[model samples]
Target: MNEYELKVFDEIEDWKRKITRRSGMMNRVSKKAQEKINEFIPEKVHELMTESIKGMVKATLFGSQLTTNRKQAIGLSLEERDELVRIKISSFQKTAIIEGAGTGAGGILLGLADFPLLLTIKMKFLFEAAAIYGFDTKEYEERLFLLHVFQLAFSSDEIRRNTLAVIENWEQRKKELVEMDWRKFQQEYRDYIDFVKMLQLVPGIGAFVGAYANNNLLKTLGETAMNAYRLRILQKAQ
Candidate 1:
């Protein structure tokens, strides 16, 4: 491996360890609290939420593909691709921040709208990242991989560990997997972001909270996406 590739390999190793690490006391307590709250919610409510998120995500996936540049980067080294992806991440982050501030300023109605808007921004960035990495997002398995990457960024510690394993072995694992578990996907994602996002609905501080939360969220997603594609590329070299 070149020096840049080796440096990235080490970074990926550190990221792998960090992601699969055990959760702290606060995380455990928070997860349990969320679970208790979830139990009190009606089953129908859960079903409705799952279906809503599923539809929203499916629509975003379709729309992102329509808008994403179809041309895959070719004849580029890992460093070159990484440079392009960093630029894309910065652009998307700015977009997310603006959208968050706008929706958040509009109160509850617009705060609610931030969910889908932010989701679309994240997915579009993932598609761009995939293309930069020379992966064709139009391919079914590639899109599915992006979903796993999304889950990895937002899930609880246990789910994150399991999802990382799937991503790590995706070349072989994709053959065995038919489709994602939409219920689990939606629940985990919602649970992960619920607290901070809820703060975005508060009338007084909603706009500030929304912009700050979205900026950090997009940053997390960008780091996760980069390391994920790095893992795949470096592993293939091995």
Candidate 2:
């Protein structure tokens, strides 16, 4: 395999390590939660969490494979790598929001939609928001920044460490990229341009924000909000 191909493999390996470690952490958290629940509640709650995590692992694996394949197909250079990541991250983030808003059977568009369409929406929403809020520079900038961050897949320390390790492996393989120089990859150019064109045909926004928001927000706000959200959803079903 060429340097590019090697880089992709290395990245995959790192992803595996990160996923394993994170999964372990999640497992521990789930175990502790189950213990607490079992203390008060009569029956075992193991199956629900166990099943959810199983599904999460499956989803994680699928995402990793898709990303690896795309990276290999495009033979992305350092520049293209950044661009691809930006596009994917932003689109992923927007999809998360839609998911949180409750899309039901449709799933989030970014996760399930055609890639071209998903890419298109991210760009369109960004520009349209810019035009509408041009004079209000602060808000526009904030919105734009949030959009970019949403695209950033792993921002939290735990997730970031794993992501960085994966990127570092790629950096080692793609020596020409100057070791983690994602900035030079010009991800914004491809991500934004593609998003704009796609918007005319299909529209969307940030999934990462909601993920991060849910994690961070709930962390600070405590479990009450989560329980409330859960109870509400359950109530709706009943």
Candidate 3:
């Protein structure tokens, strides 16, 4: 499983930790927002809200491993925040494009449920930053392909329940293992791969359509592809 799959269950908890973990930065962002409060909202509570906005934005931009997240977050101004959000939306739109180009059944299965959730969260920030951005029906076709794939692959009720159970287990364990031991994590990772292979067979579909049934699978492919690209670029620099 990739980090996102590992993170799926405890997404909110991890986010809470990330926000508090950088308290000084949070304070600074809050401080700035407080300064702008009189002009923006005139309410004292709204002024205090600057920190929450700042912390949330900071986390959204830096928290996710997606390159688009990091890229759009930099050098932002209040004026530019809206545009940044647009870029973030477009970035995911491009992901929809790639998913359509061919991630096969496995890719499609993963995309349906997963993409919408991911897009929903990403857009929540993007939309709030600027009111104009919202979910597009035009993008539905490709995203639907993903949903179809997931539904087909994990068609059985029992398998879905078991998969979810493991996900919950991973989430519960992760908080306790925040400063995880690499060697142990590595072993667990190997086991994860083994488990995925076993589950993949259960779907009994073609490569193109198979694993797409589960939302988790597409995330793995997307992350792995991006990581490989980054690794190659770094290798060339060396």
Candidate 4:
């Protein structure tokens, strides 16, 4: 590997180590508390949450209609493509911040609206990222790759490791892979953002919390997408 690629590989190792590390005591406690809360809730409430998450997951997985909308940057080097992606990520981050601010300002009602809206923004950004990286989103497998990238961005450590393994060996694993578990996807995603997103529902400081949280979340996704594609690209070069 060249110097830059070597550097990226090292960074990927660091990221993996960080993400796969055991959760701290506080995090474990928080997770346990949430689990307990869920247990206490009526089955009907659980059913409603399942339905809601299912709807979000369906909207995400079943429809990637934006594939054609992401203009491809043909004839670019990986470095050039990623520079353009940086620009795209910046633009999308601004859009997310605006959406978060607007929703947060509307208090409880619009805070609720933020879920689906943010999901749409994140998916669109991923589609555009894939296209910029010279991956065709029109293909089903490539779209499935995007879902794995999303999961890697938002899943728990154990789930993230499993997702990363699939990503790292997607060519081989995809032969055996079917659809992802929608319930697991929804649970991990909700759990990953539960605390900060809860703050976005607060009446007084919701706007600020929403904007900050959305900005950070997009940053995380952008980094994950960039590195995931980098691994693929570099692996192919080898």
Candidate 5:
């Protein structure tokens, strides 16, 4: 690896340590509280949320395939690919900010609309990032890898660790996995973002909160995707 690649490798190592570390007290407490809250939410509501997210995600997966550039980038150095991905991430972040602000300004009805819209934006960005990194999103396993990347970004610490393991050994692991656990996927994703997203439904400051939250969310996902791909590329070189 060159100097830039070595720096990225160091960043990936640090990210791995941070992600796999145990959650702090406040995070654990918050997670427990969220679980308790989930118990009281009627099963029907849970089912509705699960199905809604599942449907939207599945739709986005297929839809993004049709729209994303199928050809992987060729002959680019890791530095060049990373630069392109950073540009793509910035573009998607701006799009998410605009969508969040617009929907949030409209209050409850539009706030509700933001859920599916943001999901679409995030998934589309992942697809594009895959192409930039020279990964083929057309393959089912690669698409599934994108979903693992998503989970690693938004899930609780425990789930994040497990997902990271899958990502780390994806070439071997992908052979054993046939499908995703949609139920677990939706629940973890929903729980992770529910609080901030709920704040985006408030009447007065919804727009600002929505924009800020979406910006941070995209930033997190972008970082996670970049490192995840970097790990794969660097590991293969080894």
Candidate 6:
């Protein structure tokens, strides 16, 4: 490997270990507490939420012609392509922060609207990032890869590990993958963010919470997407 590629390889190896590490006691405790809170909500409410998020995600996947059509770059080193991706992530982060604050300050109605808006922003960023990394998001397998990257960012420790394995072995494993369960996808993402996002509906502090939460979420997704693509590209380098 070249110097730059070696550095990225080391970084990605560290990230791989971090994502698959066992959850600490505090993480387990927090997850249980969140589960308890989720139990109070009705099953019907949960179903409706899953459906809503699924619809938004499906719309973004099939309807939006935003980033999926971008021709993958050529004649750039991995380092140069990653620089372009970092710029894209930064732009999307700012857009997410603005959307979060606006919806949050507008009270419950607009706060509710934040879900679909933020999902779209994140997916669009992924598509653009994939293109920058030389992956064509219009292809089914590439889009599936993006979803696994998303799950890796927002799932529990065990699920995260499993998803990472899928991403790591995508070329071999994808033939076995028929379809992603949208309901499970929706549920996992929602469970991951339910508490903080709920605070975005509060009367007084919603704007601050929303902005902070959304900003951080985008950052997490950006990091995950970068590392996920690195796994593939660096493997090819080997």
lDDT of each: 0.91, 0.34, 0.34, 0.83, 0.91, 0.86
* TM-score of model 6 vs. true structure: 0.91
Backbone clash count, each prediction separately: 0, 15, 17, 0, 0, 0
After best superposition, candidate 4 residue 152: deviation in angstroms?
1.0
Q: Compared with the true structure, what per-residue lDDT tens digits does model 6 show for residues 40-89? A: 98999888977777778878977544536476567778999989888888
Better of 4 and 6 by TM-score: 6
Clashing residue pairs for model 6 = none
* CA error at residue 233 for candidate 2, angstroms: 42
Q: Which residue window of length 10 is worst by lDDT in model 5?
A: 68-77
After TM-score superposition, the amount by which residue 137's alpha carbon in candidate 4 deviates from its true location, in angstroms, is: 1.8
Q: Residue by residue across 1-238, what tens digits does model 2's lDDT show? A: 4565455445545544543444356544644554454467433444453444334433443343333322131443433443444454455455544543332223345433433333233333333222222212133333323233222332333433543443334324334332232321123222322322233222233343333442332232222111222222233333
TM-score-superior candidate, 3 or 5: 5
Off by over 4 Å in 6: 23-27, 36-48, 66-69
lDDT of 2 at 28: 48
- So what's the TM-score on candidate 3? 0.23
Better of 1 and 2 by lDDT: 1
lDDT of 5 by residue, 39-87 (tens): 9999899889878878889999999989988565688889999998999
Using all chains and alpha carbons, the TM-scores for the candidates as numbered come to 0.96, 0.28, 0.23, 0.89, 0.95, 0.91
lDDT of 1 by residue, 15-104 (tens): 989888888888778778889999999999999998999899999999999998767678888999999999999999999999988888
Off by over 4 Å in 2: 1-43, 59-68, 71-74, 103-238
Q: Model 1: how far is 61 from its true place, Å?
A: 0.5
Estimate candidate 6's alpha-carbon lDDT, on a 0 to 1 scale: 0.86
Tens-digit per-residue lDDT, 112-212, candidate 4: 89999899889888888888887887777887788899999997667888999999998898888677666677777887788888898888899999999
Clashing pairs in 1: none
